[model samples]
Target: MGHDKLLVLTDQVAVSLATIWEAIKVVRKEGFEKLDPLIITQASSDCLLFEEPSSTDDIICVCKSFEFPGDKLLANIYGVLKPGGTILVYLASEPPKGQTMQSPLERKLLLSGFLDVQTSESSQSLAIVGKKPSWNIGSSFSIKKSTPVLPKVNFDDDMDLIDEDSLLTEEDLKKPQLPLGDCEVDRTRKACKNCTCGRAEEEEKVLKLGLTVDQLDNPQSACGNCGLGDAFRCSTCPYKGLPTFKLGEKVTLTGSFLAADI
Candidate 1:
């Protein structure tokens, strides 16, 4: 009835487009050649290239791989989409089953700005096919917060983002992982307040060369920036079985140097 539009984000040539274009080509090949498709191809890097969009109902969003910024892409689709329009996503490629479990991709869609989205059973395809109730950009989105939300960690002091369980303790090259527990105390869901801990008095966990407990602690409380909740650990905070000092134990502990931030 009216002109339709599509946005493809996949790097693969035709394999991805086969799903949409194939369907259209099939319909066209069958003598219904009246359809005219307006296809806009883009990479995940330039998600918001189309700054001026009048409608999303007839648009499609494709990504080489569905990911974080893709969530914002979906939101963009929601903004211009007519009621009941579809948002299609293609993967860069498949990863191991253990890796793709639950499709972290859906998070990208939700993060992008789309609402009421759902993932498919195959662990690859995701869709958000609905028009958000009409509202001004200001009314629809909040200025206090950012779209495509990210995990928040508020350490009183500057801390490393290395992944827990990593054997490497290199500070600059630490792998980032989800933030875990409080070094001094257990952290609430996202308690903004700081927890207090004292230095370790007994033997400490040595990383590479078996440093004595004395080497670890230099201040009030001491701890290796170990893994989250003692489960996974970071290189900086390794699992040396360092004894946490009791009320008034011996000497030595592992913790950070007290800085203004902490």
Candidate 2:
């Protein structure tokens, strides 16, 4: 229940393609075209490369009581893959004990020249799979700190331009402060965006210590990610409600966290 031709090269499958007479006998005994036979071999990847392929042929790499080199097998499969064709790489993510060496294979694949290195526990198992990272040379854009229109704050706009080749540093990913006076310091300054959540805590503490609560008291607002519930949040962690101290109508922020004092 396979293909037209049968090119069984396993030592177990003794072949006799000697004379045209014997060849024809073997061919008739098998199935279809001798040219389009299924390749069955255990040769190392290096050796596999030297072999040729027929357009309508299939190469099957089998394992029988053998531990094949993963990299070698990968090379062999790739060498024969038709341009844009896929190769099903079978591997067990779980390794034997005492092997602290996590195969850098996954990370390496991410950084590799190839596209669509599908992983199960990585993505496919999660949902509709087979997505690849695309080059966005002149494509997508995110103007977080670059534009004042963006609501996010507590960021230093100093390093807004991201170098295409540079990797994200720890600091780059960290939440930063809006430049000093990046927003107008004028009392007439209105909220371009709502500073929601834990910001209230800051206001509460400031009130407790008798500090000004101008920023948090502003009425204009924006819908932060926190389900749009009745709360002002820390620009950093918006899900947690901001702490507020209501000391005789003066609100101040005392601490930072999901659940801190009022």
For this target, which candidate reaches the highest lDDT against the unseen true structure? 1
Residue 253, model 2, lDDT: 50
- Residues 39-141 of candidate 1 have per-residue lDDT tens digits of 5544454366454554643454444443433445556666656444545454334555556623565555555554555543444443433234445455455
lDDT of 1 at 39: 57
Model 1 is weakest, by summed lDDT over 10 consecutive residues, at 195-204
Error of 2 at 182 (Å): 50
**After superposition, which runs of candidate 1 have C-alpha atoms over 4 Å from their true positions?**
13-17, 22-35, 66-85, 92-95, 122-131, 134-262
* TM-score on alpha carbons, each prediction: 0.37, 0.25
**Candidate 2 whole-model C-alpha lDDT, 0 to 1:** 0.38
Candidate 2 lDDT, tens digit per residue, 30-80? 443334445444544334554433221223222221233245544544444
Could you tell me the C-alpha RMSD of candidate 2 in Å? 25.8
Which candidate wins on TM-score?
1
